[model samples]
Target: MKSTVEHLSPTRVRINVEVPFDELKPDFDRAYKKIAQQVRIPGFRPGKAPARILEARIGRGPVLDEVVNNAIPAKYQEAVVSSEDVKPISQPDIEVTEIADGERLAFTAEVDVRPEIELPELEGLAVEVDETEVTEEQVTEQLDQLRARFGTLSGVERAAQTGDFVQIDLSAAVDGKEIEEATTTGFSYEVGQGGLIDGIDEALEGMSADEEKTFTSKLVAGEYAERDAEITVKVTAVKERHLPDADDEFAQLASEFDTLEELQENLRERLGQSKRMEQATQARDRLLDKLVEGAEVPLPESVVQGEVDNRLHDAVHAFDHDEERFAEFLAAQDKTREQFDTESREEAEKAVRYRLVLDALADREEISVNDQELTERILYQAQQYGMAPEQFVQQIQQAGQIPAIYQDVRRSKALINAVRSVSVTLPGGEAVDLSDLLGPEDDAEADEAPDTVEGEVTGESAESTESAESGADTADSTEGTAADAKA
Candidate 1:
């Protein structure tokens, strides 16, 4: 077998492969044998059919077709391997060129090659982040979160004030024409929560049980059917939050902490830890932004288009399948999908570029994840998902997500390490501890790298291909921790 490659672009190549007659003979013979078994000859038994006799009876076209079909893929692989070009991550476009009796098998394959990036200087990237300390107010906020968790709802006979819980049946109308209405059997609302409209909350104020109130409010256009909606709400009940005393007895009932002081101290420590983590995240992101902005590279149009199409597909599915949910998401963001894509394309590009930059940094610095670290991270992630570590590892493999997680961990470590290498001058002129700035115990984990190439990944293309959902879990865990700390 012989192979030759032609460079089509910086990220693509075309390979032409030819299998000699000697190499093609084995497949041809195998094909003939298979055909013989399937066809019958007049003078021979079914199992004892001769290739020549079968070929004579069935003709050469079928046998040759079978031989070509069987040989193309194998030959193409060999051709790719034998050539001086790197094989593709995706399936190659294969085209058979020649196949004749006692002749060589020939084919061509075109595929995208991994780009060879010339990494820019990365040692002095600038990052601007909020390095504010965890204040008493922040601590109090954390404590409030905990209190909210243990708070109880109680019936009230007074007017519904801001922060008061109210039970009501809500209906919406346009020009006195009822559009929607529903009676919630037992509902609770925190008046200042802004969950219901401003007008509804205002009307509910000073309204007690059995007191009916009606008001009109404007609905944000597009998300809801009406441009501006007129809603009529009837306050059926009034309730207020009853929080337990923050003392030793409450502490004992809520958690392992036996005293309120102990709980507060624990909450303070947790809040401090949380703030440090946030600061570290902010610093890392700022540094990444600077690096991406500084570095210059020609992004493959194919890669960007692929990413955009995939994102668009997900967006379309979200909108079409769950319009209400999608609308709610848009409302929170204060923008529609079209508006978001236009405004956020630079962010998307920055994300792509930063991954590439970090990967290059990892390679330059020789960063890696050892087996033990991989196991520990995987186990930790499994525990987070509420699964046994071993079972979760197996599930990750089955779902083909282990590599993605591994790559993410590697890139994160690389980014942390890069930030650690820099000298940070804070706005207040205080020297920042790199280790603390990167996150707790990040230094120890930064040294670990994957042991095998099976899950080995470099370059941002594959990494970005992963689901953009890790941050959601991080946010949930942070919120939960905050709430637990307050308790």
Candidate 2:
């Protein structure tokens, strides 16, 4: 067997391969065995029929076809791995060029590949993030939130005011025709919370039980959408929330703490930790932007198109793939079809460039994802999707997405490494340190590299082919910690 590569472009290549007939012994045997089981010979039972006899009965064409089909994939993989410089990122387009009965087999495969990238010096990377500090007002707001959780609502025979809860019946009419979808009864709402509809809060204000007010507002949906409609809200009951006094007894009931001061201090510390994680997130994003913008990356058109198509597919699916509905959505967003296309293309190009830069950085730093790190990532993802770890693992395995997940983890570590190398500062020029948020850097993790392309440490994809989404979990955990602090 022999192979040679031809450079089609910086991001693609074509490989030509040829194999002698003697090299196909194993493939031929497997093909013959498989075919013999499917076809019954005169004297032989099941797969016991000899290859030559089977070939004679079925003719040489079918056997040769089977052999070629089975051999192409394995041989193509052989050709690719043999070439050290050829790192394919996409599936190959394979074409069999020749099939001389006994002489040799020849074929060609075209694929997209990663181009050599020149990385910027990591030490020179710098970014600025907001200073993180917990304010007294923020702590007080959190404390009030805790108090509100333990508050009780009591019935009151008075006009509803701000912060009061009310149960009401609502009816809407457009041009003297009642809108059934917009009418409801026994709906409970909080005054001043808003968001139910335009002009609702004002209509409900200063109204007592058994009192009704009719107000005109514009509807956003249904046959009378965007048209003026009259809404009548009848207040069925009025109630106000009453809170327990902020005292030592209240603190003990709300949490393990026995004093109000200790609770406030705990809330302040929680808020401070949340602020630090926010700083870490800001630094990671700004640093990534700085690094990617400074580097020159050659984008693959196929990869970019794949990403753009994925986005478009998702966008259209939301509107049931109806052209008019999609148009309305774009119009609502104040975007034209041409503008959407251009933006999607631009976003896809940026995503491809980001992944390429991070992959190069990972290569330069000899980054590898340890089992512990990978398991932690899986657990985090499982929690996010609200599935048990084993269930999530099974789903991903059936879909053959484990490699994609592995690539994402690898890219995240690469981005984190870049964040570690860069400088972060506040607006006032004070240096910001986020080691406490990002966790400590391990020397062995930094030094280790996957010894093989498909090794357990590396997982798969010797060279990653896509962008990563990470660092958002930093904010999520911070929020969880803040909630825990409240408890």
RMSD of each: 8.4, 8.2
Model 2 CA deviation exceeding 4 Å by range: 157-162, 168-187, 194-235, 443-487
Task: Give the clashing pairs for model 2.
Answer: none
Task: Compute the lDDT of residue 120 as modeled in candidate 1.
Answer: 48
Give the alpha carbon lDDT tens digit for every residue of 142-175 in model 1: 6677777899988877888887888877766666
Q: In model 2, where is the ten-residue run with the lowest total lDDT? A: 478-487
Clashes of 1: 9
Residues 1-487 of candidate 2 have per-residue lDDT tens digits of 9999999998888999999999998988999889999999888999999988987899999999999998988888788778877766666778999998798999999977667888879887788988778788898889888998999999999999999999999999988989999999999999999888799899888999999999998776665555678999999999999988988898899988989989988888888877776677677667667767777788766666766776577677666677676777677668999999998778667766766676677778887767766676556556656899999889766654555555555656676667778888999989888765554574323323222111212122222222222111111111000000000
Error of 2 at 217 (Å): 9.5
**In model 2, how large is the Cα lDDT of residue 432?**
84
Error of model 2, residue 338, in angstroms: 3.0
Name the lDDT of candidate 1.
0.60
